[model samples]
Target: MRKLFRRQGEQRKIRDKSDLIVKSNGQRNSELEKGINFYAEYLKHLDACSSGASQLSPSDEAHTQNSDLYDGKATFATTQSELLQKLEDAYQRESNLEEKLKEKIKSYQELKEENVSLNKQIESFTTGQTKLAEKHSRDKRALVEEIVELQRRLDGLTPSLALKEAQIARLETEKDTANNQVRNVTNQLQCLQMKLDEARRDEAVISKLDLERRDEMDSLRNSLKRFEIEIEDYKEKERTFAEDLSDLKRALREAELLGKKEKAIAEKALEENSGLIKENSELCAKISLLEIEIAQLNKDNEFRKMNDINLAELAEIRESEKRSKLEVSRLQEKLKAEQERLHNTEAQFDEYRKKEEEVGQWHHRTQKELEGLQTLSSSLSNENKLLRQDKLTLSDRCEELQNKLRKKDEEFERMRDEYETVSEHYRKVLEKLELETALQHERAGEYEDLVNRVHQLSASLSRDDSSSKSSRGKRQTASSENSSGKSTGEEKVQFIVLNLADLPVR
Candidate 1:
């Protein structure tokens, strides 16, 4: 009994420990689930921010146009610098998140290891319970066998003393019935134990699924992190492109203004060149008239040399030709200057065309870049959509698993209740068996006393016969009375056996 009680106490302690472990595991699981949910939500928020940035990117062009060129450039420079700083900050944040994720992974690994250990402990505890149950069953069987043997001995000893064999047979039948009840109860207990083991196995499977889900979540998070980094890189490129576009637009505008000024300067130079050409033609005609007049005067002089004319007129004509030659020289120099100015204007115009071509090329390149960025943004959005779908599917699976786990828990609780009730019934049966054994011992003791009294009466009757043998009649009378008393004693012994046998087994 003391051993049984001690075993019960140990079993209770083990049960309590198991319960504590289970509760702790449950709390840890809940905490892990909460952490996972938090990370999931955070990832969703990041995706939203990325999508919003993509949506707002086109509007930046309109905003850029509204601002003054120089002011926009300055602001763009500052914003680009700030973006660089923010990118750096983002990198730092990503590193921190990675470190945190690593720590979380480590903690999760530790939890997994702890869960495994706990599962092993649970298994060991279950094995111990099974062993204890087997030992109890063995003890009960041994006790039952001992009771059967004791009853057999009582049956043999009391066979000739009274008509009590039928009562003993009935007691033996009752013992057999109790034994069968114990066997049936034990069978039921075993079945319950099997169910409990299966429940535990299911729990282990659920834990495994949880771990797999966590691993998948980690992978998804890593992928999302990579996508975020790529998105940030793309955003930086877009900002740089936008800045370049703004600068190109500014330069193009300045080039256009310069080209217009040069065109006007070229047109004025062309008009001056036309006027200089007409003046040069008029001066050449005047020079030609002078040459003809000079030829006429020379002919007249030749004729006058034969018949004498004034030298003064010829000298005056020579001075007039010299002045005309000087005027022609001045006009020719002015015309040369105008032509040089026209050539310079043409060169400026050529340079302006080259610059315009360069602006067109830059515009084309920027457009292509914007188109590429748009395509990249579209792809990223598609990926985000896919990721969101995956998350939703994972969540649904998790919910289903949770529901299954809840059902398993409910079943486990029900099994535990059944086990407890069965154990209580078994304990009651054991107690009743013990009481029955105790009663059997008392009855055996009373039977031994009756046997001793019978032996003593036989011894006294033998002495009386020996002492009164000479008075034969009186001896016969005394013997008959002794026989009657012995018969009465036998009847009393039978009555006691019947009464003991008639007692209910329960």
Candidate 2:
């Protein structure tokens, strides 16, 4: 009996020790698990914070389902202190993450600026066409000066060429005069043979001298007049070249300006988009906090309040008015610039018109040349006409080619617009398809979850139904036995025990 008591005491002591160890082990395990869960929740919260996603707060992280343990126990105090230290570490990590986000924003802005500069370079490349225009302007003035010099030289030379033509005419006249002189000399010599020949010979010499002087004078005057006309025509050609150059330059400048304008606008819009993204992130953060607060306040029955919002905004109105005024001023400046450009264009057009007039002068000069050539030779005039016809054909062909090019450009523009529209529409379709696919996936997951939940509910309902039926059967049996002369209270007590056995413990 003493040995049995001693063994029993030892067993009791072992049991108490084992229970204590097991309880401590279980507490350690629970604490470790809580720490692990908290860490996971912390990580999740950080992720949610980054994306501005709706999530639980730090208090939620520290909270537990076992409020009793928190209220009554100092046992987990060391572990709780460790977790608090971890939370502080997490807060530091969050602060670091915020710094990283700011750096990312700064980096993004820098990249955007770099992209804008690159785009500016691209626009400048597109505007390389303007350089040709500017060259045209310089070339115009140079060509005009060159043409004027050429006209002056032509004028100086024209007199010689005219003089030559006039000399040839004089030669013809001298030939005629020589023949007449020959006839007179022949008559004089014939008559002088019969008489004294000195007076007739002297008269023939005087007539020859007079004829030569008259012929020389006629050649010189004709030469001078022809030279003057040729010089005038050359001057006109110079003016025409200058006009063409100026027109081309103006056109190039306009194209360059347009390219820069469009590029600037695109860059501005991109900046606005970035700003909007930042604002959206801030709004989402605010919204998440509001949602959590609202959820927490939802259970309070005293929160029946309807508040009216007076959205009297001042900054937006002031900013908008400022922008409107700025826009108006910009429009006015643009209009003024446009007017200046218009005047410049008009001046260029006038120069071109002057060039056309110069071309008319060339036409007249060419006509005069043709007339002279026609008078000189029939074959030459026919060849000149052929050359004119060739020039006209070339000009017509150039006009036709230019028209075809313009049409092609317009067609290309239309095709580009259509392609852009198609691409945009395709992009929208892809986005919609992605959204639908996500929705389908979500619906599929929800369906599976619902199916699993239903199976679980069905199983629970079946178990409940079976237990209810069994309890009813036991009660009916107990009642029947009572009717056959059993203790009714005892049977009722037995039925209660059976029902108690069927129920699960909390």
Best by TM-score: 1
List model 2 lDDT by residue over 327-437, tens digit each. 556655655665565566556556655655665565566556545544444543454466556556655655665565566556556655655665565565556556655
Measured over all alpha carbons after superposition, the RMSD of each candidate to the real structure, in angstroms, is 54.2, 74.6
- Model 2 scores a C-alpha lDDT of 0.51
- Per-candidate TM-scores read 0.39, 0.17
Clash count per candidate: 0, 0
lDDT of 1 by residue, 1-506 (tens): 35444545555655565566557555655755565575577557555655655566566744543443455457556756765665576566557655655665666566566656666777898899999999987976565455435334433545455554455456557656766765765676577567656756765775676577667667766766776676677667667766766776686677668667866765676676567667657756765775676677567667776676666765665576567567656656765775676577567667766776776687677668667766766676676677667767766766776677677667767756766776676577668667656766665565456455555544443443344343446457655654455445445555555554454433
Give the range where candidate 1 is weakest over 10 consecutive residues by summed lDDT. 459-468
The 10-residue segment of model 2 with minimum total lDDT is 301-310
For model 1 the local lDDT of residue 28 reads 51
